[model samples]
Target: MARIERVDWLMVDLAPKVPRSDAIQSFVSQETPIVRIIDSDGAVGTGYSYTIGTGGPSVMALIERTLAPLLLGREAEDLEALWRDVLFVTHATTVGAITAIAMAAIDTALWDLRCRRAGLPLHRLAGGAQASLPLYTTEGGWLHLEQAALVDDALAARAAGFAGAKIKVGRPLRQDVVRIGAVRAAVGDAFEIFTDANQAFHVDEAIRRARAYQELDIGWLEEPLPADDIDGHARLAAMTTIPVAVGESIYSPAHFREYLQRRACSVVQVDVGRIGGITPWLKVAHMAECFNVAVCPHFLMELHIALCAAVPNARWIEYIPQLDAITTQGMRIEAGRAYPSEAPGLGIAWDWAAIDRLAIGAGQVTLGSSGGKR
Candidate 1:
């Protein structure tokens, strides 16, 4: 059994390829908090979570002050038990973002250790249902892009051989309809198109917009309503045929169960980062499968790709590259799909030198086996 030896993490600023905004929030730069869990042996495992330009320090402190210490000298191989321990300790703060983000860093690191010890990649270790999953691009689909720009971006994704492309929609119904129409005209009827409103709609307005999108043959309407409004989503789903996809902001598997039981959403976009990492993520995916719903996860494609490949219900992986600058390698994409690396770990090659260059000086903490600050 591998005993816990130390835990380390760094806060780094990772900017997107462009300045993108959605209905509710503007993503200035992704504030990334990563964790490195070292066992008694010389081996190490890494995991991370991010916020869209906020809360990096709080997540880091939560790990250092609360989560990391509980891990000291524990069996690193029992990932599920450790995951439960941290979640139970942080129960007061959880079912929320900061605590969940902190839980994700450690939980994922433990899974990395499990996979490494078993001599298998995460996809294989988890389930290995598929070797590759279809891709859908969300890079150029911010809510602020103009009609012309949106059309050009959709066309670009189609030309590059993507299975689908998503555009943000929160404008007035007429304007949003026209924008989607323009994109459809450019990319033709065969190419798939999806829309995300970033939880910007209420029940009445969401119903109206879903009606407008039905004729467009849109793939799915993602986050059309606030994630917490399960009854409203159920009403909207009942009112329209446009598939309602929600899950990015969802914080726990219990919340996902509420949506699934109510038949509130048709597509389950379980995000590994937000739902407290792979353990709960797999739970939600399997939960969705029991309901015959598709699992197309949100951002963090690098990590999600492996989880997506592990489950039978995972249909698509959203293409949003965030680690290109800080990592030595990138996602393996071809033929409009993503392939997870077969290497015996999480698969991305992190460049420690580059992360050090971008890491923030404040709140950078590491702990030894004693679980005290060094």
Candidate 2:
């Protein structure tokens, strides 16, 4: 059995090549908290979670002070038990972003270790339901772009073999409708167009916009209402034929279960980082499947491709390139679909030199038998 030997973490600030804007927030930079765990057998696993900008230091502190100590000498393969132990110790802070984000980094690293030890890719080790999954592009659909650029981008994405593209809505109702119409006209009737409000609208506004978007043969309406507004989402979903997609803002499986039971959403947009990691991520996906709901997970496409391929109900993987500069390789997209890598574990080859150069000074932590400091 491999015994945990040490844990180290760093916060890296990643700026988008171009600024990404949605309804509620303009993403200036990503605050990524990365964790590495080493076991007695000399195996290493790395995992990470992200925030829009703030909270990286807080997440790192929790990992270094509370979570990492709990993992000190445990068996590396007991992912579930270790996950529970972390949660139980941090139970006071459970059901919130800090707790979940910290748990995600640890849980994901464990899964990565497990897959490497088993000598299999994560998809096959998880279930291997399909080899490749369809792709959709959101990179070209930022809310700040002009109509001309939006249309041009949609056309380009279609030519690139992507099956669908998501456009950001929540501008004035009329403007949102016109933009969707412009994209639809450019990509034509055969292409699928989805819209996301990023939780920018209230129930009535969301319903009004969803009604207008229906004429465009839109694929799904994502996060139109605040994530906690389950009643509003159910009301809106009942009023419109367009499927409601959520999960990026959700923190736990219990929230997804409530949304499913109440019929608040049609598409499950589980984010591995947001949902605590691959362990709970799989649970949420299977739970969605039991309710006959389709899963179309949010970002981190490089890591998500494996999870999507492992589950049968998984529908689409959002294309957002966040790790391009720090990684030697990333997800490969071809003819509108993404395929998981055959390489063992998460299949990402980190460019350690680049990561060290880009690492932020404020959020680094190292823990060993002497404990540590963040």
Pairs that clash in candidate 2: none
Model 1, which residues run further than 4 Å from truth? 361-374
lDDT of each: 0.88, 0.88
Estimate, for each residue in 265-363, the C-alpha lDDT of model 1 and write its tens digit. Answer: 999998888999899999999999999999999999999999999999999989989999999989999988899989988887899999988877323
TM values, all candidates: 0.97, 0.97
The superposed Cα distance between candidate 2 and the true structure at residue 20, in angstroms, equals 0.6
Question: 1-374 in candidate 2: lDDT tens per residue?
Answer: 78888887887899986779999899988888888888888888888889888788888888877888788788999998998898899889878888888899889888888888889999999999988998888998999999998899889888989888999987888998899999998889889899999999889888888888898899999999999999999999899999999999999899999999999899999999888999999999999999999999999998999999999999998988989889998787778899999988887878899998887633322334465544
Span of 10 residues, lowest total lDDT, candidate 2? 361-370
Give residue 88's lDDT in candidate 2 (0 to 100): 90
lDDT of 2 at 203: 91
